[model samples]
Target: MKKLICSLLIALPLTTHASSTLRCDSGLISLQDSTSIVSSKCGEPISREFVGYREVQDEYGFYNEVAVEEWAYGPRNGMFQFLRFEGNRLIKIDSKRGR
Candidate 1:
């Protein structure tokens, strides 16, 4: 029992960090998916906000400004999923319980 509890505790953070994927009605959306792909699978988010711009460096050692945005889709099971995008790719997925 103790070993099981310890294993579960160690695995908790890994699950939390693996929130980079979301299941939609059509398909699954994951990190690095394009904005168009996410929108198509998720069928449009409830809200989209322009977060700002991030400077990203490429393999060529050139830095460019990429648009950053957050798209929210929710109240599904009383939880909201927020997707963060940089440049045109989905970078992160977060979920929170709604009030």
Candidate 2:
């Protein structure tokens, strides 16, 4: 019984995380700020109309601020990601996909 309870406790967070992940192409996306958009959705852009952007971050205990600007291109699924920063920590994300 103890083992079963321990397993459940460990698995609870994982289950919650898995359920919380929303799919790509399900959020706000902008060509002007592709870096913030894709980073939020785990998007890896291959190409961009604006080339690229630079990102910087400052470390805070148990948190971080990150910035990324990248574009991705696929045979049938090109995309853009615009990374946004919060005091040095990236806390929000959005993405746009080519269909």
For this target, which candidate reaches the highest TM-score against the unseen true structure? 1
lDDT of 2: 0.37
Tens-digit lDDT string for candidate 1 (1-99)? 345434434433332323878999899999999999999999978777787999999999999999999887766886667789999999899876644
Candidate 1 Cα lDDT to native: 0.79
Q: Which runs of model 1 end up more than 4 angstroms from their true locations?
A: 1-18
CA lDDT of each candidate?
Answer: 0.79, 0.37
Question: Model 2 over residues 2-33: C-alpha lDDT tens digits?
Answer: 45434333433322111112345547443343
